[model samples]
Target: MLHTLPHAEADFRALVRKVTMPKPTTTRRLTTEAGAPIADNQNSATAGVGGPLLLQDQHLLEKLARFNRERIPERVVHARGSGAYGYFEVTDDVTGFTRADFLSAVGRRTDLFIRFSTVADNLGGPDAARDPRGFAVKFYTEEGNYDLVGNNTPVFFIKDPLKFPDFIHSQKRDPFTGKQEPDNVWDFWAHSPEATHQITWLMGDRGIPASYRHMNGYGSHTYQWTNAAGEAFFVKYHFKTNQGIRCLDAAQGAELSGKDPNSHQTDLLQSIERGVYPSWTLYVQIMPAAEAADYRFNPFDLTKVWPHADHPLQRVGRLVLDRNPDNVFAEVEQSAFSPNNFVPGIGPSPDKMLQGRLFAYADAHRYRLGVNHTQLPVNAPKATVADNYGRDGLMASNAYDRHAKNYEPNSYSGPAQSDQPLSAPLALTGHTGTHAAPAHAKDDDFFQAGELYRLMSEDEKNRLVANIAGGLAQVSRDDVVEKNLAHFHAADPEYGKRVEAAVHELRED
Candidate 1:
C-alpha cells in the first residue's frame, strides 16, 4: 500500500514513521555572524524546552536583527541592467589625437567592465520595453579609472540638466495612480520642442533593440582630447557593433515582453558562455578645437549631432565582451561609472548636460555604494593606486594609506598633486545669471528631425507613425495631442499628418 503511493508522498510518510526526529549532523555546526557556534538553532533559549523563551538569547536576537536589514536601495534610474567583463584593445594608434597612456600603442589592452540598461525602468521591469538604453563603460587604465558614461543614442531629449528631473518624472509612474501616464509624458514633451528629435527616434523601430549586443553605443557628449603638443580637439566616441544593428517593432517588442521579459539579459550571458563574444569597433569623430567657436550649430548642444559629412569617423580601438561576471551583485550591481572620472588626455566639454552629470553620477555612486565605493574590486583601477585620505565607512576594508599622514604638504613623504597641467584653461566672458543658451548661426531644432523622417524607408515610416499614434492615443488631453502634432508638423508635414490621422482613428475605435 505504501509502494502504491507517489514517491514524494511515500518518502514523507517514511520520515513521519520514524521513532524520533532525525538529529542534525554533529560534524558541522551553524555559526552566527561573529563566528560563534550556535547552540540550538531549532529552539530558542527558555526556562525549559517548552517554557517561555528567555530574553538573554543572543543567537536568536542576532539572527532576527540581521534578517531585518539585508537589502540596499535600488538605483533611481537605469535600474534594470546586465554587465560583463571585457578588454578594450587599441587597434590603431590615436597618439596624434590624445596623449592618454592607454591609447598610445596599437596593441595595448585595458581591462574594462561594461553595463547595459534600459533608461526608464525599475529593477524587475521587462527588458524588451521601448526606451532609450544606457551604455556605460569603465576602463581600468594605467592613468586612473576612466568612465565613459553614455547612452545608445547620439542625441538626448533635452539640452540642459535643469529639465532632466521633470522629464524623467513624466516618464516614470504617476504619483496618483502608480502607473505610467501617457498624458503626463506628452504634456511635458509638447512644451519642450527640443525633445522632438529624440521623441522621433524613440517612436521609431530603434526604440526596442533586438538585443544589447546588436545595438551601437555612443559617448553622446562632445569631449576634449589634448595631444602631446597641447593641441586640443573636440571629439566624440562611437562603438559600432560588430554584430550589426537589429531592432524590434512595437508589436514584436510587446509580444516578447509577455513571452520572455528577460530576453536581452539571457541572450547576452548565453552568447558569451557559448564562445560567441560580442564586439564593437571604437571610432571617434575629431573636430579641430578652433572650429567649435565658429560652428554653424551649437557644438555643446546635447540635442544635436555632428554630421558625418562634416567630420568623419576615425578608427581607434575595439571593445570585446569576452567574460561574464563571476557574481552579478558584486560586479554588476555595485559597478559605478561617472564622467568626472577622466584620464589626463580626455576632459569634459561645455555641454550643460555633461556638466551636470559630472557631479550627479559620482554623487549618486557615493550615496548608493558608500563613500569608499571606488575601493571595491569592480571599480578599483588595476594600475598602481597611491591614494592618501582618512576614511572609515561601511565596507572600508582596503585603506590605501594606513599609517601615513592623510594631510597634504606634510613633512612625511605623502603623495602630492601631479605637476602636469590637468587641462588648458578657457576664457570666460559671460556673467553668472540664468540666461538662455546662445543661438548658433544656422541652428534649427526641427531640421534634423525632418531629415531623419525623410531618410526612413516607407515601411519604417509606417511603423513609426503607428507606434507614435498608438502611444498618443492613450493620452486623454486633446490640447496636449495638438501641441505634439504641431511640433511634428514643424519637422515634416507628412509625418505630422500621418500621426494625426492615425491617432484620430485610434480614438474613434
Candidate 2:
C-alpha cells in the first residue's frame, strides 16, 4: 500500500494527444561515414562472407572500429541529454554592464551549442525520473568558449562542496545492496536540513519537468561581471522559456517513464524538426558590488534566491536552439564545458558552489576525456586560438607549438597572458578559519518548499502529497516517515497534514 501505481496509463495518453511518433520511411541509399555506398552492409567485406575474415578489407576494419568506439564513459551526473545547435542573439544594450564581447553589441549573434540533461541517472535511465535536469550551454564566442553551467532549479541541494559527493552517493546505488536505499537517501537529507528547499522542488511537479523544452534554465550561481570602466557587479543568470513553463505530476512522470524512457529526448528533437523552435529569454539580475554588504539574504548563498521584485530582471539576450545534433555520440557526448573559461568582462564570485565547479568541471573533463579534449570540435572556440603552451596529449590533433618558446614569462614574442583592465583588485579580509554559512533571519530550509506547495493547484496538491507518501511509505521505519512529515509540517502545516494523512491511509490499506 506504500507504493503508488506508475502513471504510464495517464502519461502515454498525454503523449498521444500532444505528439505522434513519425512513421519511419524506408530508403535504398546506404552510405558509410566517408560517403561510400554500402553495397553489402548486412555482410561486412569479409573474405567471401563464409571464408576467413580478411584484415586486408579496409571497409570492414573501418566499420568494426567505428562500432567499437561508439560509446564513451557516460558522465557521472547529467548522463541522459539531448543537444541542439543555435545562435544566441543579444536583444538589448547591456554593454555598460559587462564588456563580454558576446553581449557588447545589441545585434551581435554568437553560435551556441546547448545540452539538456537529467542528473542522477545512467545514460539509458528514464527521462521522467524525479531529478534535476542540467541546462548547460556552450557559447562559441569570438573571445573563447563560454560555458553557462546551469540547472532547471535556481537553487541547489547543498551550498558546501564537502557534502556534494556524499549527497550524490545517497542518490546513487547503495554499495552494500547495489540498490537505492531508503535509509541512505534520508540519512543524508535529514542530517543536512539545507537540502529542504531543493528537495521540495524535486518532490513537486518541477521535479519531473515535461521535457527539456518546457523547463526554464538558471546559471544558479552568483557570478561577477566587470564593465569597461573597471567596476565589478554581482550577477545571476535566468533563462525564461518563451514557450511557457510546464511540468508533469509524479503519476504522469512515473507512467510516462516506463512507457517511454526517452520521452524528453524525442520531444526536443521533434520540436525542432517541425520548426517549432524552443527559445529562452536571457535576463540578468545585477547587484552592485558596493551594495552586497547590505543585502537581506547572503547574496552568495546557492541555497537562496534574490527576490525578482527587489531586483528586476534586465533583458540581455535571447537563445533559440533550432537544430538538433547531426551525430549524438560525436557532438553531444563529447561536449565539454567548465566555468574557468571566463573572458575579459565575466568572472567568478565568492559563491562556494561556483568556486568548486570552476575547478571540478575542467578537471573532470581532463580525467574523463583528455588534456586535448578541448580540440574536439564541439568544445573548440569558434574564433582563432593563439597559444604557446598547453600542447601534446592523447588524441592531440589540434597541432603543436609553432613557436620557439613553449613556456610562459619568456622574452620571446610568444603570446603573453593579458591583464584585465576592467577589474579593480579585490581586497581580502576574512581570517583563515572553518566557518558556518552566514545565517539569514528568516532562513530555514523549509520555507521555499512550503511556498511551492501552497502555490500548487488542488489536483497538483493531491499529486504532491500522494507522491511523497508513495515514496515515504516504502520506508520500513515509521519513524523515518514521521520525520519527513515533520519537515513538511514545518514548511506548511497543511502540507504536512496532507502528506501525513496520505501515508496513514496507505499504511492501513
Question: Residue-wise lDDT of candidate 2 within 277-305, one digit each (tens)?
Answer: 99999999999988876787888888888
Residue-by-residue lDDT tens digits, candidate 1, 405-482: 767889888878788864544446878998777799867778788888999999999999999998888889999999
TM-score of model number 2: 0.86
lDDT of 2: 0.83
**Model 2 lDDT at residue 493:** 93
What TM-scores do the predictions have?
0.92, 0.86
Q: Which structure among the candidates has the greatest TM-score? A: 1
**Shift in Å, residue 64, candidate 1:** 3.9
List runs of model 2 lying over 4 Å from the truth. 1-66, 401-404, 421-426
Candidate 1, clashing residue pairs? none
Superposition error at 124 for model 1 (Å): 0.8
